[model samples]
Target: MEIYRDSKLILEINDKDVNLQVFNEKISMPEFNNVCKLNPRVKITDFIALKKLLNLDSTEKTKIGELKEIYELDISKDEMVAYLKIYLTNSEIDRDVDKVKTDIISFLNSKNILEGINHELLNSDIPSCKKFVVATGKAPISGENAKLVYYKLSERKVKEGTDGNMDFYDVKLIDNVEKDDWIGEKIPPTLGINGKTLFGKIVEPKPGKDAQLKYEKKSVYENPENGNYVLRAKFAGAVKFDGKKIGVDNHLVIHGDVDYSTGNVDFDGYVTIKGTVADLFSVEATKDITIEGKMGIGAVKFIKSRDGSVSISGGVNGKNTTKISAKRDVYLKYVNETSVVAGGDIHISQYSMDSYLEGKKIILSPKNGRIIGGQVKADHKIITGSIGNKFEKKTVVNVKGFERVMIKHELDSIEIILKETIGKANKLKRQLEIFESNKSRLEEKALNTFRALIINYDNIMDEIARTNIKLDHLEDMLKTRGDGEIKIVNGVYPKTVLEIKNLQRKVNDLMSCSFYVKDNELHLYD
Candidate 1:
């Protein structure tokens, strides 16, 4: 037993087979088989305890059957890490732990798994019999991108009143900014971190991209501090952000009423009035005009930009003396006893009383959009909730273009003139014929009258011919004009006149209908 304990068996693993060296001590085959069972890759099919039973005296190296090499070391495609797996086979040889460890380390070094090695897992008991995770790799963390934080603007509309008025105080009419006010800030991008793989390969992360700040001239300034950018206003005015650029327009602000003391204001940029535009006062702007208070009697307001639109938060009480014109669209809370002309569309939120409005299109509010006691002319369509009052004070709605109306009027005038001229020409022709027939029986004065009558008749005939030609041309033009329509959502009162092109219809009773031109006549449809 001492000899058996003092002697050791040498094991070697090669590419094809495992070999063992037996010392000159009595060896128990059962003990060797038990040790072989520790390696999953080694198994014994037949065991004869020859050394213990026969007491063998020879000490020689013997060859064991092939180890089968069923398992392999797996390396990831990214060369990040490595793993080892072992499989059972028919062999009776105890595996050498030191030799297996050296082989695993050599394989990992060949695949470049130089970092994050799990040595304890590699040296664990019966490591070859189980799957072993030998290495792990780190992944890089990317940095955040830059962003723009803008100061948002207010988005509130005018509030409606119970007394058929609009509350202008609820609307945010201006986004005023003082000089050196912070408009926006640029959140800078952070630097990226470097990373490494289990194969000792260096990974470079992509750095965050930078963006520049854009601003209008004399409106904003860019400030850079500690790798961060900020945008500040340069002058006191109305600030606006147009997606890519920030701008400020000089605004003329009137704190008090636009009365005789304020006179008339004509600005090239934006205008904001805190109080009412009193009677007979005029306000004009090349860009936008905002009135915080109500529009008084006889006030005049105009916006010149063909592309710019106007928004009137409060109502207008024109008292038959006010006039408003915009080259583009006009949005109003309410209008009373005024004349309005817009090159584009007109949107009236509330009621329009005794007002004359003309535009490409006229649209009234969905609720309480009433038009009473005046005329509305639109080139395309006139949409309203109600037209005319209960008493029927003669409201007129013309859906034809103004140019067509003027042309039709001209044609009528020409026809009247042509009738008068033709009648005069016929009378002169008869008189001249009578004078020629009695030429021999007339005195010197009568002969002179006959000669003068002949010339006068010829002149009248020429004039008649020219006038007839002009009338024909105007009639052709009237035939070529396009048609327009009027749509009343609620009702049209009696005595309300609806006209399209040259056709006109007078409402004798309340009717909710749509009026359009068909076959040169105004037709009403449900």
Candidate 2:
């Protein structure tokens, strides 16, 4: 019988006699004869030596049936699958199909690769001369995160005209939104798919994160039909979206001049005029008013909020016909031939010419602060660099006198009415007391007269009480007088009049001094 051990040749006779054992690459004739001697019943033709059958030389180390399995196995960290690699050291060696398949199966099972196993490479003929991959694994697909997509109306830009002429009407100053206008849409996150490993293990992918929309409740709301957020304009005006929050403001913006083309604007909210307010046109706002350009000739602008302010980047060059009023502070680049009023402080960056300006406090820039031919009134202080021009133009600076005069006049009127009411009440009370003492059960005419007298007395007393309250209020206002001052930084030229409270003084020369009311007299500090 013939036997193979480690791909070497072995000859056995019956069950007990062992003759030849050849492990070397080459075998001599003596070795072959010895193998025949050991197995007398076995014909040499029936059993052939491994080295002789493969025709190998003595220097070679591998035989035809003695090839060792040389292969590599790699498993991914994600447990997606395993890869099988096979190589051959000798290209002449015939590969064992069953052994290669079994070895590859054992390797994959060792690495716990139990699912998605490709059996085509295992069942097909594998080349021994080159290396090849046998198996592959699948990876999971990731999902996208949620995002917000804004509508067109929320970010509309100004359209330029192609007519070759610069038209201010082509610019869109404000982004307007109507009620139930689509503002933005929210895209929801998607769920990730599950993946399988080469080792039959499950791999779960991370899901995308979700995002919520933020907006003002009164100005925007989420639509139930499409799950999109839309703008709900509480008032017809401008719309704003700050990436996070969406809001709508009650305002009207004019892109062009307020003229016959665009009628006078009367908005309940803020008003922003990008162009000039034309002559004889009026722009009024219940809130704030912002004029980006200069006020045209004879134009009028007003703001009504005591807390809201007005800003005119371009000065009011109204030629004595432009009138501007602000309930709060007024900010201007310059004022010329205009009348301006503010409840709070007024800041003028440049000179004022022939303007009547009134506020709680008026300040002009010291660099170009010239109040020439203007009557400036402030409750507290009036600060300017030059009071009059080089030609000694007539300029008047009055401080803390308007409110005092008005309050005093009101107080006087209330006192006179109060005195008359008291006199009338005393007269009616005396008449009523005399009538009541005259009779207990008087005639109808007398009773009616007595009741009338009592009514008149009570009415007069109420009137006196109301008048006293008014008088007390006015008196308190008069007592709290501001320490008003006229601060002249550079100088006050001749013919410039300075008034502090009730006292007035004319500067006859180039005087650099601060004037204030002291002891009912205008005092000057140089």
Candidate 3:
């Protein structure tokens, strides 16, 4: 079967003695029927492997010289495998492949591999280079101290010398991607001094540049495949796009939508997002801030609050030299890892260690809260968690270890079982049992009722802690009451004093605890 340059399909045939793989790459075909052109010694298996290794599918654009300019490159098999990787993978590979490819190009340019190779390539507008060794890591290792093998790819020739002895490979390179299809095309073996070696050409910058630098601009280039604008220059200022005369730190405006979905919402003014502020419309306001909604993922800021204290309340997004401030006593109730100059005290309820905080004094209420300044300096208390971070009655509380339990869980915080509620239930049950039990040995159901009352005592304490009910005369009732209880009728019946002095005015603190300790060894059961 004869291979044509028109298609991507590879046909293999075997009639009697001869077996062949017909590759559609025209440059790889023989120059004559009688004389072997180049690397005729290379096995057909290796050619098929190289094609597969390059990851060239039948549909990945096989036509050349139309959308892409055609090229007939000459290189060695080893170097070809290394260079072809760029187009084969979606992103850049490791540094070793780049280094090897660079060496081949350098060698060709210097004309050290084969004399007139560089001249011929240059005359054809194909800039080639010769590989050379440069020292890194202070100095080269001494000859007597190092021994390594240096092998040639063109010839299976291994040369021995001091530790630093080395020679380089050569390659023919074509620049100008649109005009040169050589970038993605596989070259024949004749590019090297010895015809047995094959190398692949890539559409890229010069040798040193390809190995060291990366291509990453917003408007500099247009990817024919991706159809997106590559950055031409580094960004200098913020650009908020909502069609308003936004405060730009720089100039030259474009479409600015407040969503990280495309890029980032770059702004230098007060960002007022009418939408959910889904991106938090992160801004660097030399003044203060006010987001009607919550901050989206990865949103950061250096904002000033209405409160004198500069508070952080979102993920770090844009860099702001301006101090972060709040309106009232800035409540870090919902602050995250965003930094702030914090001219005033910083209230940190829960912040990430990755967050940087600088303030007159940081009031941390997070678990195991850490400080990174040379010295921890706080004038007031450094509450790690809530003094009673909860809500009871109508008052909110900050409680120790309150961070462990969630208070805002869907409808759970509202449905609380207070100590008074439990006591009322217990009293009703006990009265029912006394009037209802009809046996000497208490019925199992009655026993179960009593057990449930006992079981709920611990929960009662948890409710008290959760409610933070600081009843003014509660101690008096529990401690200094009359023989039974004088506050209400049939006080032993355990009815809640709903109208006690200053009740329902205390804060809430939800922490679970039960048996009151009488001594080192309490007169208590479990």
Best by lDDT: 1
Error of 1 at 518 (Å): 11
lDDT of 3 by residue, 1-526 (tens): 3222224333222332123322444323333221121112112333444344234333332212111111123334333211111111112223244553565456444532332233232223222222212211111122221111111112212232243221111110101122111111111111112221222223232111000011223312222333222222233333221111111223212233345653334343333332322334433333233332334224432344332222223333333222234432333433333454454445543432323444433454333232221122222123233222122212111111111123224123433445456666567545544533333577788778756654464355445544443231232223421111111111111111111111111212333211121222211111
Using lDDT, rank the candidates from best to worst: 1, 2, 3
RMSD of 2: 26.5
Q: Score every model by TM-score.
A: 0.59, 0.41, 0.19
Candidate lDDT (C-alpha), each:
0.69, 0.65, 0.29
| Clash count in backbone of candidate 1 | 1
> Per-residue lDDT of 16-39 in model 2, one digit per residue for the tens?
333344455655567655543332
Q: Is candidate 1 or 3 superior in TM-score?
A: 1
lDDT of 3: 0.29
Off by over 4 Å in 3: 1-282, 295-337, 366-381, 386-526
- Can you write out model 1's per-residue Cα lDDT over 1-526, one digit (the tens) per residue? 0111225565555655555656665657677766566455553332343343224544454445446454567777876666767564222212466666676677678766788777887667534355667787766667666778776766645465675444445656458888888888898866678677887777776665444455675788888866778888888887776454678878788898777988888777777877777776678877666776665334555333333456676778777777787776777788888888887677787888899999877878544688888889887577777898899889988876335677789988888888998899779867765665466799999999887876676677668767776676556445533456677777889999888875888899889777777557667776
lDDT of 2: 0.65
Off by over 4 Å in 2: 1-217, 220-248, 294-307, 401-482, 518-521
TM value for model 1: 0.59
> lDDT of model 1 at residue 111?
63
